[model samples]
Target: MAQERRRRPARGHRRAAAPRPPEPGPVLELEVERIAHGGVAVARHEGRVVFVADAIPGERVAAQVVDAGRERFWRAETVSVLRASPDRREHAWPEASVDRAPEQRAGGAEFGHIAMTRQRELKAEVLRDALHRMGGVETGAAVEPVDPSLAPGVDPEAGTGWRTRVRLHVAPDGTVGPYAARSHTVVPVASLPLAVAGIQAVAPLTRKLEGAAAVDLVAPAEGAAQLIVRSAGDRRSSRGEPPTIIERVGVRRFTVDRDGFWQVHVGAAATLTSAVQDLVDPDRFDPAADNQDLYGGVGLLAAAVGDRFGANVRITTVEADARATEHAGANLADWVGARAVTARVDRYLDELVAAPDAATRGLTGATVVLDPPRSGAGRAVVDRIAALRPAQVVYVACDPVALARDVGLFRAHGYELEALRAFDLFPDTHHVEAVARLAAIV
Candidate 1:
């Protein structure tokens, strides 16, 4: 064989070139313009929107792009403050920064680095922005700070020690702590500065919970503190007795499941109840005008209305959860004309809308006050409520975006957003509660 050329290795047998590692992202200096939703600060990098966590508006900071691959905008965290704002303060919870990564920081207290007053200012900016961008109605509705006088035992200067409810994660070693932002990593918490004294007192119970997945500490306004140990196998059952606690809204007392949804802020109930009553002004409406409370948890708003307008106001409260309805019925039992109906809000609205006119159905001039969940009462509910030509609709909302979207829906149905009041119920975090009053356009 003539010089048999050495056969090259078959293509299939050839070694593959090492896969290239992902390119390192860019780091740049950003001048934060304003605080955005989700506890982030708005900044621009080469004309691209960059949301920087742990940064305050009016500050220049060095940031690294954490999600550059995203198309519309980029996400970043402040690497260092190049120009600190007056609002910037030492983090209230230093231990929360156990990990260098912002997403790995302990949960809650996101605004610990900002002063309490400045935190409220930033939250107001966020609310205004949401209303303008989403609701398309930019009136001078402002976010108001809670006066310490409204809530007893609350310190005006101190933003900590207000949380009456806390959920802690359990680590493999039986230690309980908070989960890192957007992560399952648990950061051991020896102390919770944001929790009430009663919740803080039960910190030692974590070690006793071996097989528990997490623990919920609930300290209601009236009643002994209750600890609920959640297991990994079954989330429904608790290690101890079902924690039922009593909360007061004005003079009305409500018995609520400890694990259920209640305002995290200790003084939230009192403030919200007062705001709702002020806006709804049930006393102004006709006593026979039917009033409905959607998502009425333990009938707080119903109770408040009943207190103002008396039992002859013809109030009907709707709640989906069986347990909550049971508690609501019990709570409203003393009110003669106040009744609790168990039904999903959407389904109930569907029936109410399809039912004969107010005169025929005996539900005339209905005034609705709803405390819907974060997702908010959708357009269907708004349209049906509007169709009923209700004189007043009071909405209690937790998420600004949801409120803005629903505000749009209300406008589409010829309902005007007459008044909106924002509250800093959740301090040191992104959450804020808002009460909006809508009136049908005559």
Candidate 2:
């Protein structure tokens, strides 16, 4: 009986134990060195570059890699701050906090965690880096905040409530909020701190609209506030009717479309208008000076130039969007020699380059001002402007990288970057406005 029991037990002996799967790698601990463009902090870990969102400079952070599988660089968000910077503050917007999940981070202000002064410093550094790295141009001065006098009408202390325009995504269930950063997922917002008084007023009411795909709120300095609701199937409506707003630049009035291109910041329009007028110095040029405003949205710059030149300078505004061009014409109707031309900037420049009569084409010793989109004026337009031998070219740029690229193009055509004035028109974000003065190297 003992032998039989032993044999039976030995036969049933052991099943092999399962091998355990490999354990996941650890979350990295990194010292953030500085803030980079696009509202991220730069750090290095074990010789690999890391970009940490929602972290400030001089902070030690535990970051979980969100992207970068076997890549040279990694994208991460701060999981925990081992050591925090003095510049770090509790985020202004509750949705921008690090404790919030990644999907909830899509639509809040990027610099909500940074101090106001430090935010400007970081933006200045970004502007400097873009100029030096992309355009090979060394700035004599860093990006500067706009002078308070430039926007006297606006309360300088009301920086957070300066956003005159805001767009929010509408969820399927009619919840309205900002789309999470780089995601289509809606992050329901009970309050938007960055919005102006008018937008904040309408944000709550948006939930009442059915089948809404998106909602836009605009509050102009000189007009009634309006809301635009775009529903599914492209149907659009406002509270009452399609709304238009008037923007006042000096004594000039511009009727901008409710859905069209306009500066989002409340102080931006006035600051930009004053900067353009100062840089162009229309008074310094001859009365018959040929001036062009390319990518002129609603003729803001054109009107400014015309006002300074007193309707004597032949000013032509080129706009690509039909809606914007129509508004531009209306805005510039009061100026005698100012006209809006609806054409792509490149095509308009090409026509100027190929015109048979240079004198008749208004290309000789002319001065040009271009407030191009974020993509910039491009090399072809720069070349054409050079061929025309303009005395000066004033460039208003929203994207530093694009401005740097076009600056390099201008340099290739023997144009020198005379002056660059970078303004903190867009605070609490990575965006800055730059007015670049390029003079022909005569």
Leading candidate by lDDT: 1
Tens digits of per-residue lDDT for model 1, 1-442 = 0000111111121212334433446778999998877888889978989988888889998887777877779887677888989877777667554225654577787787888888887777888888888888886766676767656655545577788878787766777788766457667756788888888887653374567677768888897767766666554434465457788765678887765666778888788888887888453466677788888877878887777677777788887766677788899987788888888888888787777664365345667888887777778877778767777888988888888989988988888888888898877887888999888777
Candidate 2 lDDT, 1-442, residue by residue in tens: 0001111111111222324423334578999998787878999988998988888899999987777666787788777889989988777667767778766775658887777788878887887788888888998645566576645444343347678878777777877788776457778877777777777876754365557777768788785667766655453323464356787765667887665667777767778877887887443455466678888878888887777667665788887766677888888887777788888788888887777875455466667888876777778888888877777888988878888888988888888888888787866777778898888776
Top candidate, metric TM-score: 1
Prediction RMSDs, each to the true structure? 12.7, 15.3
Question: What's model 1's TM-score?
Answer: 0.89
Residue 89 Cα positional deviation in candidate 1, in Å, after optimal superposition: 1.1
Q: Which residue pairs show collisions in model 2?
A: 106-180, 106-181
